[model samples]
Target: MIEFWLCAGLLLLTALAFVLIPVLRGRKLQAEEDRTALNVTLYQERLQDLQAQNAAGALNAEQLAAGRDEAARELLADTEGAQALPPQRTLGIKVPLVFALLMPLLGYGLYQHWGAIDDVERARTFADQPKTIEEMTARLEAAVKSDPKSAESWYFLGRTYMAQERAADAAQAFERAIEVAGRAPELLGQWAQALYFAGGKQWTPQLQALTDEALKADPAEVTSLGLLGIAAYESGQFKQAIGHWQQLVAVLPAEDPSRQAIQGGIDRAREQLGEPVEEAAVSAGPGLTVQVALADDLQAKVQPGDAVFIFARAVSGPPMPLAVKRLTVADLPAEVRLSDSDAMMPQLKISGFEQVQLVARISRSGNATAGEWVGSSLPLASKTTEPQQLLIDSADSKAP
Candidate 1:
């Protein structure tokens, strides 16, 4: 903010210089003209005295002629090298001087009305990572204040408020986001979640309506699915809870950490209804088991946190993965199962393809399509039940 104000001050000074420099020059030219007029007046008075002397016979004609020549010479000397001045403008100097005086005030006024100085300050504040939740909340609040129309800002601010357990504030932030960005399915889901918490976790018609609207727009919307499951469980609707959670489990990626918690909720709901827990039912699908390991030489180059993507891609169809599982380099040498339930999309599943290629890639940046190290197996039957060995043993020549 200080830097912004400093730059503005410098620019204002430059503008004043442009306006006032010419006015100063005009004043100096006027002074020179005044001096020339005085010199001409002295020359005229000397000529008049000489003419008076000649008329009184106090001096001979030649003497008078000499005095006249002297006066003329003196006059010429005084006016020598004077350039003819251009016609002066009636308002040039005065107008610019007045404008120069008002420029700073007018600029400040216009800027206060329309400038993005607060945005500049917010940008500078956001450049550095916030070290605490309070700091993060403060930064996010300022960001929304600076750019109320920025749906992204409002969305993140709402998320931050949620983290801080300020449910009411979070609800308001999400509402603002919906106003700016429209009722996007994700935003609707978040807004419903916030409102539910803000209303003391009690299920309400408003909450139900919001979730319904969100799911109507996007059936796979995760937040609404989870929130609905929770509400059903709390209300003793075990069967409804199970249904909602199962749908959520189906849409979530296989490697999502939240899957375990959600599955726990499903099992609890089933137990509440006196049904036997069925773990296999959740993951039952055609799958390929693979043992993945990092290359010995490249192990030293990778960090424990580096992302390892293990997936199967169709050999004769689209390049998109049939199924995928994500892990970290620290989890290398571990066995993973890529199954129909792990499919990236519902229509694209391991069972849908005839032949597939198994791939293991290590990416420092967590991108599945491109990575630093990769290994792949030749095309094989998608229904192959045998476990296979895959290694990240080669540099990824196709990495971008």
Candidate 2:
């Protein structure tokens, strides 16, 4: 701002020079005009003296004629090199001074009302690279506030919010971006991710709709596919997770930094389901029923779409599940049966375990192997006819 004012003041002075130059020259011309008039007055007075001398009879005719000729010569000499001056204008220094003051004031006033000073400052601020994410985000927030309809500003703000883990705010910023910039598929995917995380990693119909819409618009939309994979994996739908992740991987360039992580996730998912990477998965099982219900104390804190993993494992054996079934909080207090079809491997079966432990876990991050809540039943014989009751009333013994 100081720099701007300095430059503006210099410009105002430059303009004042134009007006001041002519006023100064007019004063110089006036001085010349006054001297010319005084010379003419003195010439007339000399002629008057000669006439008085003639009237007093102090000179002869020849002498008077000689004197008149000499007087004419003197007049010519006095007036030599004089030219007629043009009529002076009534222009005054006061008018120029008033103009000088008004020119700067009016110009400065108009500029303040509609100038790029803010933009200039913004540019300068950015040039001095911000040292932190918080600083950069602060600048973006101010930019959007000043330009509410700038789609680019909103987009970057959303990304920054996402990086800062303010998913809800990120979601709002992406929505504003789409409203201002149009429904680009990438924007939709980002918006969906923020919405998904903002809802505590629960996959709702709204989130599903957003990802579905994004993929429909651009089949290879990476964020949408990655989100779907996350949702599927957390819900213990390993095959579906593999499919989404594989698709995402295929679309990504080989040099992409995310490809390795995503591929690792796919491999982990396939391994969890005991499916060979080279072959498609097939289901088999020794089926059994378990009824799952959340303890009343925990019902208020969980999402309906949160992943629920139910499985039966040998009481004291390999520690691996013989059979597993996936559901969600929405299916609570309901009986879900796992069979040989739910076996982690082609050979593993619930029928192999004479005594098994039935377990249910609710994972917020979509990882069936780990979660925030868990419930299990005491050892029961495979021949046991009663329905096993599982209560997800306690915190999980593991972390995601």
Candidate 3:
């Protein structure tokens, strides 16, 4: 918000500066013209002298005519010499023209290139969305299997473990990645976050060292800012937290999710320290949970944390689409249940499911990309029944 206001203020001031310069220049020119009055005086004196000379017969008709022409030329030069000095720039015209034409175009070009408003928002949504431990672990295993040398995969796996509240596992993953990746700023940031989470809410020397490393690599790192701010707040350094968050807000765009997220955190810290919070509660909206499992036949080969997508279609009548759930391996269970009870489950009449199909597949990322189909597409008698089970064999899982 402050950054936006500052840019807007600068643009406005530039516009005014352009507007007033021409007006002042024009007024100065007019005042000079009025004060000098040299043209009028010179022309009158020349005309009177010529008339007297002509009357005294000291000048012939030709002489009088030539003298009159000379006087006229001198008068013209005095009156028009200032016009030849230089052309004055008119801000009244140019300023509005530039603002009208270039402002919108320049603003649009800038937005199209570096203004990652929507892209950042989408990434934020992905980041904030919940993932089960099984799903994350499956992804990590697959990533490692595919490319054992990828430090980024290891770092992500560590971060994922941290998300699942498995701090020790996360730390180990981060450590391994650091050994291979070697001091990447983003990796350091994630490593520090994991260390802090594992350290029982106290800043350990190791964690502080990682934090310092991350900040040194990139002072504007968002994760670093968040971690540092939290540390400051916890240590009763409310003002320090505010300063970090304030700097973050300045760097982030006006519509950035992190901007709001960090600002809210800062406000809460301030309020806790007896300072006024500038915002109200932010609503994150409703959430849903879904589970997918492979059939019993496929259990030996199917991993729990594999990624899967579940689709349910009504069996009878028009054969309408019923529901679709995307899930990861960590979310799978021996028996899968779909009902209104799950927090993430969407609202359905709960009576429309005639037949349900389950499939398990291994995605390119080492996670379950698909689910094996179970039972026939035949019509079901009721929606609410015992939980459905889909089984797949281990041998089949490795098959193409």
Report backbone clashes per prediction: 0, 9, 33
Q: Return model 2's CA RMSD, one decimal.
A: 17.2
lDDT of 3 by residue, 179-275 (tens): 8889877778777887787887788888778878888988877767778888888888889888887776776655442354566678888788887
Cα lDDT tens digits, model 2, 90-135, are: 5777998788879988998899899877688768776764444567
lDDT tens digits by residue: candidate 1, 152-261: 88988887677555889999999999999899999999999999999988999999999999999999999999999999999999999999999999999875645766
Stretches off by above 4 angstroms in model 1 are: 80-92, 145-150, 274-400
Model 2 misplacement above 4 A? 34-102, 105-115, 147-149, 277-400
Q: For model 1, name the residue pairs that clash.
A: none
Lowest lDDT block of 10, candidate 2: 278-287
Best by lDDT: 1
- TM-score winner: 1
**lDDT, model 1:** 0.85
RMSD to truth, every model: 10.7, 17.2, 18.3
Worst 10 residues of 3 by lDDT: 281-290
Which of the two candidates, 2 or 3, achieves a greater TM-score against the reference?
A: 2
